[model samples]
Target chain A: MNWHLIAAQLLNGLALGSILALVALGLTITFGLLGLVNFAHGVFFMVGAYAGFVTFQYTHSFGLAVLMGALVVLVVGIVVERVVIRLFYRRPPEDQILVTFGLAIVIVEIVRAIFGGKTQLFPMPSWGMGATNLGFLVYPNYRLQVIVIAAITLAAIYLVLYKTRLGLIVRAGIDDSLIVNILGIDVTKTLLAVFVLGAMVAGFSGVIDAPIVAVDPDMGASVLIESFVVVVIGGLGSFSGSILGGIIAGEIISITTIWAPDYAQVMLYLAMALVLILRPQGLFGTEGRL
Target chain B: MMLRAIGDRSTWRVELAVAVFLIAFPWVFPIIGGYANLATRILILGLFGIGMDLIFGYTGMLSFGQAAFYGTGGFVTAYLLSTGMLHNTLGALAAGTIAAACCGMIIGYLCLRQSGVYFAMLTLAFGEVFYFLENSPLAKWTGGENGLPGLPKPVIPLGFTTLHVQSNLALYYFVAILFFVGYWVARRIVRSPMGAVLRAILENPARAAAVGHNVPKYKLAVFTIAAAYAGIAGGLLGIFQGYMPPDAFSIDQSGEIIIMTIIGGAGTLIGPLVGAGLWSYLREALQNLHGVGAFWKLILGLLFIVLVTLFRRGITGGITDSIGLFRVRRRTAAAHVEEAPAVSGEVQP
Candidate 1:
């Protein structure tokens, strides 16, 4: 094994895994709290990228772009939750999945209509340009920043979910929503908050990932699937599992690329299948939780 | 007696009506601006949607990886025919159908281990696995992004005469016969003892299991059957178009069929066909209209949301419910009239 190639791929995997973790984190939180599948979660990611793209075009400020991306998706999440998703709470899981799937198509088509089907270039911020020499290996500045951004966001979300009172209610709701409602905690507000929070996180990750990957209406499709694999491997609704699953998925894809690039994606699915066979709950998932 | 017989579930009224519609569709559809090709596409999707309805509508298993079987069947049949490895189209189609069914069996086995969202995600992920395999690793056979092109249309040889499906109309007839058969078979399954068990499972898996039905076995069987249906549809698509596109294995393909099934109404059997017709017709019609071409999917998506929210029973379900309500009202009215005359006669006496 070539140490240099392996090391580089490992780092690349970490970067990829971090993004995957960010995306999956949102999905787990929503699934845990609301029991909603949220198939349209990826559309929020795509929307964020487009919002950031439009923002960057005017302001040329990465900070503003990120903020706009998150804010726009947050609003979109609110309207979607209020108008459509709110009605689905009492429905079966299949109904929720179907509605959200439809929502995803609608959102993607709208974006395609506005931006056209062509891939848009999201140029790296001025500060994030050039490579960083990290003693043993050189890495792009934007990618390193992405890792930092994802890590910081993950930490921030952790604090909110664990340390805050709202987090307490959310976690309690996740355990047994009916009981939480019986205790007069107003689970509806919590559900909306958690759903929007998940959407914002997805959108944030989309914008952050814009420079690294192509920004297009359908860009979220792969990320969405990969995150599903991550959520599955980590165990659904397991917070730490998202992180672990994401890294493992990233490593699998990157490392496999060394020998057979085409099989990188196939390897990820195989790993998921293996995990399903060995531990259906996932690495960090609780049995029968979701 | 005749009316009651026609209304009976065992009666051939529904079948006769469906056959009439199938025969009249080609002629009547033209008045509303539909052609043979569009109708044929609808039939293909309708055929695919029958399996979807079985597993999803009646059995309550929502699988998003049906494209795996569809692509498998299409590619296998297309590859066999295009490469001259198979001379007979019917034989190739049979092989493709079997291949898809086998794939469904394996996939269903693993995916059935989980229920609800987990199952949906597993199926979707597994479907992607097939897509990636087809696009890159197995591109030699599948022809990758360009897809497998230049396959001959279907030709059937009997002991006496040969049938060549060379024209669009001929192909439509060929597919229509297969679709009718598929529909008839699906209707049988929906009315079978196993079908009752499937419905019971759908209503309440725990109760169904409590009643001594093998829920998993039923699910697996239906899932496999659905895959077979998808496979045959895929084979027909390849033969109809004379080229198999790689996107046949895509998530969109899987999603579209689901949309069609749901739009037409799940559990209604013929609901999928209605949904396919509406979906295909609208898509074709909308794409032709100025300023509305791109928005057709958007409109459909909105319509889907509305249907799922307000009309979960779907169009067919709604219509059937209304008809049943109307019959009940008429019977009640007649009973009241008869009672009124008897009461009046007693009072006068």
Candidate 2:
């Protein structure tokens, strides 16, 4: 067995997993709080990449690009929540899915109209251009940075969700919104905050992932579906589950790519199906929460 | 009494009306600037949406993975015909439909364990699995990205005389006949006692189960039937275009069918057909207009959002609702007039 190759792939999987965890975290929280299956989440990811790309074109600073990616999507999320998602709270789950799916199409087409449908390259940030040599394998510095950034972001989210008063309300609401409402906490504000936070995370990951993957109008479709797998594997509304599910999905894809590249995605889906069949509520997910 | 008779299930007025519409669509559509090929495509999508309506509209299972069966049925039939394994077109279509139905049964069994959003996500993931399988692993048989091309036009053997569907009109008629049968079957299912159970499940699964109906069994059955509809439609698409495009298995295909079903009106059997016609016609028309080609989807998306938000019942639903309301108002007015005369007679006595 080539231990060195395995080690390299493992690290690559971690990097991929971190990004997926970040994306899934956003989806999980909104679903937990709002019970909305936001199909437009993927479009937000694409919008972030484009936002960052445009920012980088002008500022030429990856930091500013990242900030702009998050900020633009943050505003976009706010508008979408206020104008559209707010109305859907009383609607059925299928209605929410359909509206958001429509929103995704609209947003993607708008992007396509502004920037042609062709794939665009997001250059590696100047600071993240080189390779870092570990004992076993040399890896891209940007990917390592992504891991660090995602970890910090995840940690920050953890603090907000667990350590703060608002976090308590959010968590409680996830368990039972009606009970939380009866407790005199403002559930509406908390819901808005969580939704926007999820959107920002999606945007942030999209910009960070820009250098790694091709940037295109339709890029978010696959990411959205993958994150759905992650959310399912982690159990809907479970933070730790998202992280674990993301890593597992990442490892399954990367490791499978080593032998059968074509089966990487298939393996990820199979793993999800198995998780669903074996433990429908997910490994960390509490049953009946959703 | 006459109105009740007209509305009775024994009367085939609705069926007759639909038949007239189908027969006249080819000619009427051209008047509205739609061509033969677009009409055929509408029928195919409409047939696919009928199955979706059965599951979603009546059964209340909003699946996002129907393309799995669609592409499965299309590819299987296309592969069989293209490889010369199936000499009869109808046989290949049947084979494809059955293959898709089996897939649906398996997928439905697994997915039915969950309901609502979880179910949607699971189906979407599974749909992607089929898509990836087609794009990579099964590419040898499926023709990968290029898709299976050079499929022969549909030829139906009637035992005594064979029907060669060669002309565009002939192909349209061939697909139309199948669609009519599919529509008729779907109507039967919706009106049947079993359909009432499906509706009960849709309205309230807990209550449906409380009433001794097996909810899961009903869901799976309807889901399988829906898959059969998608399968036959997929097979027809392969024959219609004479080439099975890989996009048949795409998420877009699945999403678009749902959009069509919803936009036309769910729970209404003809709703999908109306939605398909509108969607296909608008798509073609918008794409042809100057400077509007690229933004057509964007416009449609905006329109879909508006409809979902404001007109939840969709075009056909809204029309039927208004018509019903008008009839009710007229009937009440007539009743009030008769009551006044009776009151005057009593006062005279």
Candidate 3:
């Protein structure tokens, strides 16, 4: 393939990876730290998108949309954690999966009801709309912005987890939830914050993704499956793993599309299967976890 | 020793009841607010759900891609019937079933090698592949986006009078018969020694393997059986609808089946019928009701969450458990001849 085509595809991959990384960040942290699978995380992403879409509609401002989407989903995440999810913490992993799966259905259905089944389109901000000319290749400016935004968000999360007190507690709890519990730390509040934060990321991804992809109730399901691939590929709880997995998945998808357009999407799973068979713990995953 | 003997008898009774119900459902349902079309749809969906129940409910494998087999079976039957390569309807249906089973065998072999969530994701990937394949490369035979239409109604010829099964009542009876027989067969398979093994696999796969059960073979066997059920159901769907929608292969279709099983009651034969009935009925009702369109799905989704949160056992399980309590009360009283009948009567809800 020519440089233009290759560059274009790489851009697409990186942009897509950014979204995956954003969404998987929540899943990885909650799963990594709290030991909750959070199957409803995708629905969180959808809700965030809807929140963004609505805020934009009302204010006619993209910035406000991101704020509203993130805030609303944060609340939603906490409510979910306090309500249905609280009872499941002590249950079996399978039960957790089932409950969350049911919650996902409920959330998606509610979104569908509130916003019709039609795709909700987010208008790109004036600055994010145009294409950028990169000497030999042309790229969508919106996609490039996504990469920048995603990188910033990733950095922010890294700072929070590595540099903040709450992040320290979460990491400590992740290593030994029982120890934290025995230490008389309010693990509940920490989990609630982490859940909200994770949810906010999912929402943020949704709003950011709106301009690039069609927004709908079922959108989260496909993305959710892909994120699972990312999580599996990147070690389940490793933040760095998610970024790596997301980028690899994005490239795999983009490159596959160049080679075989139809199989592009399917190849993601094939790659996942290959990875699982070869390295069950994933690239950044510890073998002990598997 | 006593528990084993009672378990064996209870299993036999459950199997017998399922058989009788299937045989009687067609004859009895038409009199009770049920249409032939609805019955036919239920049977096809029920057949498909059986496969799902086996994988998700019994084997604890939450697959999100059964539509692959359903579509594959439908396409094969439609292609064979449409091309006139298979004149006999029964023969075509058989071939369709076999094709689906073979596909299941291959996919299951690969998928069952992984456990839990990985298995679920793998199935979903394969499903997406099948969808792409059907819509693209196999479009010529599959009819692509439009899907194959004009599948002829099956006919059964008798010596005295050839039964020309076509039109409303006739087609209903034909489908009813197929569903009845299929349901009866499923009940047998579920109660068989093999079904026991599948259940064991679900309860604790590691322990089951530790006990010397060939877990993978059982998983693969059930997966194939489920696929075969989906295939036959898919074929019946083509026959019943007179056209198989391409959406049958869509992930949405697979998701709907999962919802149905969860709603009705997992690990119960009659659960699918109740689930499909509730889902289809609500969909129609909600759509017909004023001020609701696609939002009906939203309502259903909420209902699903409430159900899962409130009643994991589902409608069939709830009823069965209640009935079981009454039976226990009676049996416990019977064990003590001194107990009064009034005590047992008070226990009934």
Question: What residue runs in model 3 are displaced by over 4 Å at the alpha carbon?
Answer: A288-290, B1-33, B156-163, B292-294, B329-349
User: Where is model 1 chain B poorest over a 10-residue stretch in terms of lDDT?
Assistant: B340-349
A1-290 per-residue lDDT for model 3 (tens digits): 47778889988999999899889888898887667777788888888888888888889898999999899998899889998888877655655777787788778877766776898677778889778898878788899999999999999999999999988888888788898889888978887888788878998898899888868988888788788888878878898999999999999999888878877877887787788778877899887662
C-alpha lDDT (0 to 100) for residue B68 of candidate 3: 93
Query: What TM-score fits each model?
Result: 0.95, 0.95, 0.90
Candidate with best DockQ: 2
DockQ for every prediction shown: 0.49, 0.51, 0.44
Q: Against the true structure, what is model 1's DockQ? A: 0.49
Off by over 4 Å in 2: B1-11, B328-349
How would you encode candidate 2's per-residue C-alpha lDDT over B1-349 as one tens digit per residue?
A: 1121112234477777777777888898888898888999999999999999999977889999999999999999999999999879999999999999999999999888899999999999999999999999999999999999989988789999988889998898899999989988988887779987987677677778998999999999999999999999999999999999999999999999998988987767677888898899999899999999989899988989999888776777666655554554433422321231122113221
lDDT, candidate 3, at A249: 90
lDDT of 1 at B177: 88
What is the Cα-based TM-score of model 3? 0.90
lDDT of 1 at B250: 96
Question: Per-residue alpha-carbon lDDT of model 2 for A173-224, expressed as tens digits?
Answer: 8888999989888777887898898899999999999999969999999999
lDDT of 3 at A61: 92
- lDDT for model 1: 0.88
The residue-by-residue lDDT of candidate 3 on B220-332, one tens digit each, is: 98899889988988888887787877998998888788889888877665677678878876786678778885677778777777777676656675665555444544345
